[model samples]
Target: MALLTVKNLKKNYDGSPVIRGIDFSINKGTCVALLGPNGAGKTTTLRMLSGLIRSNGGSISFEGLDYQTDIRYHIGYLPQHPVFHSWMSGKEFLVYVARLANLDKKTAASRADELLARVGIADAKNKRIGKYSGGMKQRLGIAQAMIHQPKLLMLDEPVSALDPIGRREVLTLMEELKQETTLLFSTHILNDAEEVSDELLMMHNGEIVESGPMEKVREKHRVDKINVVLQEGFIPDEDLITALPSVIRTEVARGVHHIFVTDTKQARDELLQLIQAERWPLERFEVGRASLEDLFMKVVDS
Candidate 1:
């Protein structure tokens, strides 16, 4: 079931449209990634959904909530650049946020401890926010967002600023969190989305260009292509590969040949026959579908 729905969503600044009319829904208990390059209005969309900013035009519907109601009560948002009270400890900050969310003192303290433990930063709960590492601080930010046990959790570029280790830490946390709550995160990093998300919302210039389950979207854009890697210092003959009856085009980059074809079986049979006849120094050969990056480029460029 859809936990949240949007229709004709739009936003503008000084009459310049940043988010054009776009529509999508978030289903219950699924990890959805909002993907686009910078200036794609991803941040604007998230801000509007979180009720931090009002939209110029559109309607948002959350399950069990009436239209025009404050949906912020059901949403937990962690911005790209979250500010922390440097002097406060992790536990203290969370308790403070819980209190702000309208929890009583005792309940806020209990919830704060529970969340700090949940996000794997319990060991640093008493430590000052100023002393926390990037990863720990991020985990703390997540804990604060969950203080009220929101039905949906939204993160903006959760790992974009972290080091490799920090990125890995947060990504691992996200993988675990998806099992418990619906997740909506925005990212420009394709690999991270591919690794963790079940659904994708590919936006460009304030519109959703592609949106669906990851596998469905990939299959929709799949192409009949073959990749060949010759042994070191040996280059595949592009002219020879392109001459095959089934082959449409061939591109070589760093000794790897990408051959696009009209017929996969015919292309593979013909290529193998030529490789055997010419005794080509083949290191690897595989037939595959187009990658997520390739699909993103194809849609954006089109």
Candidate 2:
């Protein structure tokens, strides 16, 4: 079942529309990625859903509760650049957040301890926030977001600010968190989204241009292309390859030839036959599946 539903969601800034009547839903126990380039209004949409900003039009329903209701109670939001109280210890910060969530003092302390361990930062719980590394701070931020046991967790560009090690650490934590909550994280990093999400909402120009299961979306937008690589000092005749009946066009970049084709099977056969007849020096030939980057470029350009 859908844990959250958004219909005709719209947002405007000073007479300009930012979110233009976008619609989507999040199913329970699924990790959905909101993907787009920078300036795609990803942050704006998340803020609206988190109740940090009001939509100019449309409705947001969480578990059937209307937008007029205080749905923030059911949402845990971590902004891209989350501010931490550097003076406070990790455990102290969580306890303070938990208390704000209305947990009793004893429960707040207990919950803080539990979450610190859950996020794999129990050893650093007593350490000052200023002393924690980027990854540790992100983990702590996630823990704070979950303090109230929210049904939906929204992370805005969660790993965008981290180093390689920090990014991996937070990503691993996200993978684990998926088992426990319905996660909706926004990011422009296609690989990260592909790594952790089951569903995708591809936004562009403040609108959701495409959304569905990751595989399904890719299949629907699949491009017909073959990648060919030749050994050093060997180059295939581009005109010869493009003249094939099944081939449409060819492009070469960094010693790799990208052959766009009409039919993969026919193109493979024709290219192989030609290569054999002419004794062309071919190192590798691959039938390429459309990658997320490919799909993103196609959709955004369209």
Candidate 3:
């Protein structure tokens, strides 16, 4: 069953619509990715879902909850750039947020300690927030968001600003956290979303371009193709490969060639036959389908 339902959602600024009557739903206990390029209204959509802002039109129904009631208690939101009390230690910060969420002092402290360890930051619990690295602070932000144990968690561009090490740290944490509660995160990074998301809600120019299970989306947009890497000093038989009946187009980079085809079986047979006939020095030859990145670009561009 859908845990959250949004219908005909609309948002505008100065009489110009940014989210143009979009609709989608999130099922229980699934990790959904809100994907789009810059200015695609990803942030605006997330804001409306988390109740951070009011939509100009449409309905947001969560778990039989009334629209007129407060729903923030059932949801957690972490903005792309989360702010913190620089002077407070990680432990102090979590407890403070937990108390604000209506936990008693003892419960707050206990929750803080539990979350600090869950997020892999127990060793830095007493360290000041100001001294925390980017990754540590992001993890702390996540712990604070979950202090009340909301049903759904929302993160906006969670790892966009972190270094490689920091990015890996948060991504690893996200992988683990998804098992505990429903997660809906917005990101432009295709690989990041692909790594952890079970479903995808793709946005572009204020509308949902695609929405479905990750595998379904990839399957619907799958392309037939083969990638070949030529050995050093061997010139690729590009002209010969393009002559095949199933070949549609070809892309070459350095010694690697990507041959786009209309029929995978036919193309694979003919290409292999040519390679064997010519005794070409092949380093690698693999048949593949469109990836999430390839599908994302296609949807956004169209």
Candidate 4:
């Protein structure tokens, strides 16, 4: 059963439609990522889902309750720009939030400490928010969001401010959290969504154009990719590649040509055979699995 359902959700800003009747659901104990380019309604959907903004039209139900009323308690939202109290220590800020959520003082302290440890910010528990780095702040944001153990977590651009190492840390943390909690976050970065998401909601032109389990979606919209680095420099004729049955085509850059094959196995064999026939010096070749980025590009571009 779905923990959250969004059906025919629509919204507008300044008389311009921003989210155009998108539909999807979030299952229990899964990560559903909202992916898109800028101005693709991802942020708008996130805001509406979290109750920060009312949708012009839609039904949002969570945990057997209407989202407008009974389900807020079960959802945690971390906005892109989280404004923590600068003067308050990380622990103190979390306790403050817990208190506002009606946690008793004793329970609040325990929750704060537990979450701080869970997000790996225990060492900085006493440090003020002003002193924390971008990654540290993101982790703290996640800690506070999960402190109450909400079943649904919504994080917007959670790793946008982090360096590569920090981004990996956040993704790892999200993966760990997925063992028990359902997460739906919005991000423009394809790799971030690809790394940690089980399902993807691909938004385009201010609407959710595609959505499904990530791997299933890729398979359904499969396009094979091949990258080759020829010894020295070799350029395969475009017509030769296009002549291959159902193969999309070929592209070359910096002495490396990439083939987009419609059939994965056929592309592999055909390319190898062609290489052998041409007696071309081969340096390196790679056949890649279908990727979320490919699916995403296909959807948004179409």
Candidate 5:
């Protein structure tokens, strides 16, 4: 059975709709990425899902029951920018949130340390929230969300404030979390989503533009892209390159021709052999697949 389901959900801030009739479902033991460009309603959807904000229309069900009442207890939310009591230490803050989540005093303290360590902030547990940097706070946010051991965890731009190194750390933690909890995350970072999520929901202007399993989505958007750097002054086979059944288009830029294939894969090796046999001074030849970023651009553009 699906662990969470959103059906015909609609929400508006003031009179403007941010989430317009959104609908989707997530199963247990699965990670689903809510993806979109800025102002694409990703955060709004997450907010409604977590019950931080109620939807003006439709329903959200969790474990096959109305989530607004029952499932609220089963969710953990890491907001894009977590508000903190600057006066409180990191450890204290987590304990407070943990207590508010209904954890017992002893378990709350224990959960606090576990989560702090889980997000790599154990040593800084006593540091005041105001002293922490953006990345540090994001880590704390994640810890607080997970300490309660909620069934469906939602993170909005969880790793956005981190540098590349910090991003990797958080992504790795997220990967580990998936072993035990269902994850629904929203982020502008395409690579982060690509790394941890099994599925993606691409949103635009209050609507889901596309949604599917990660590999399936990539394959759906997959087009062949290959780069060939020729031997200096080696005349290239423009007509022959385009004639390949899989080649959607070919372009020569800065002495390198990029071949985009969309059909048969038979002659890719033969084409290289032909080029090498001619000894065209090929310095580089490599195949490239469409990345989520590539797919994101194409989908949002259309």
Candidate 6:
């Protein structure tokens, strides 16, 4: 059964609509990603779902709960910029939020300790949040969100604000969290979504352009392309590859070449033959499915 469902969800500010009518659903124990560029209403949709804001139209249902009633108790939300009481220790902050979520004092304290350990911040639990780094803060935010064990956890651009190490830390935590509950997060980073999500919800111009299981969505809008990575200082002959009957288009960047082809099998055979004949040093050659980034661009451009 779907953990959450939405129909014709619409939101507006002033006289302009920020979210056009859209429909989507989430199932239990799945990690779903809401993907889009800036100002694409990713935050707005997440806000509405989190009950931080009211939708101007449409219905949002959580496990058969009526949309007209409060469903906030069934969800946990971490905004794009999660605010913290700088003076409060990490454990203190989580316990506070847990109490606000209606847990008793003892349960809240226990939950806070448990989550601190789960998010890999137990050692720093006594330290003031002001002293925590970006990655630590994000991990704490995630911990607080899961404190009440809400059926669905919603995060808006959760890992977008961190350095590489910080990003990796939160992503690794997210992978573990998804095993415990349903997760829905918004991000413009295709690689992050591709890495963790079971499904994807793509937005453009405030509407969901496409959404489904990650692989299914990619296949639906699949573009045939081969990615060739050459050894250092080696470059593919762009003109020669494009001249082939099976090749459609070519894109080169750094030391990699992306060749769009009509037939993957034929293209692979021909490209390998060309490379061998020319004795070019090849690092990697991959053909078939378009990457998440490539598929995302195609959806946006369409």
Name the best candidate (by TM-score).
Answer: 1
Model 2 C-alpha lDDT per residue in residues 195-244, reported as the tens digit of each score? 99999999999999999999999888777888888787886677888889
lDDT of 3 at 220: 83
lDDT of each: 0.92, 0.92, 0.91, 0.85, 0.85, 0.91
Model 4 steric clash pairs: none
| Model 6 regions lying over 4 Å from their true place | 66-69, 228-259, 270-283
Clashing pairs in 6: none
What TM-score would every model get versus the actual structure? 0.92, 0.90, 0.91, 0.87, 0.90, 0.87
Q: Which ten residues in a row have the lowest lDDT in candidate 2?
A: 64-73
Please give the RMSD to the true structure for each candidate, in Å.
Answer: 2.1, 2.4, 2.1, 2.8, 2.4, 2.8
lDDT of 1: 0.92
* Distance from true location, Cα of 162 in model 6, Å: 1.1
After superposing all C-alphas onto the true structure, candidate 6 shows an RMSD in angstroms of 2.8
Steric clash count of candidate 6: 0
- Tens digits of per-residue lDDT for model 1 on 119-205? 889999999999998888888999988888899999999999999998998999899999999999999999999999999999999
Clashing pairs in 5: 230-281, 231-280, 231-281, 231-282, 246-263
Which 10-residue window in model 6 sums to the lowest lDDT?
A: 64-73
Clashes of 3: 0
| Model 4: residue 43 alpha-carbon error in angstroms | 1.5
1-302 per-residue lDDT for model 5 (tens digits): 68888899998889998888988999898998989999999998998888778899998888856524666568999999898999999999999988988899999999999888888889999989999988888889888888789999999998887888888888888999999999999988798788899999999999998898999988877766788887778777688777766677888888878787754355477567667676667788777666888888987898
Candidate 3, which segments miss by more than 4 Å at Cα?
236-243, 249-251
Q: Model 2: residues >4 Å from true position, as ranges? A: 64-69, 237-243, 272-282
Candidate 4 local lDDT, 1-302, one digit each (tens): 89888899999998889988988889998898899998898888988988889999987777667525656678888989888998999999999999877789999999999999989999999988999988899999998888778889999999887899999999999999888899998899998888899998889987778889988887777656888788774655667767878578788888877788777788889888887888778898887656777777777778
Q: Which ten residues in a row have the lowest lDDT in candidate 4?
A: 63-72
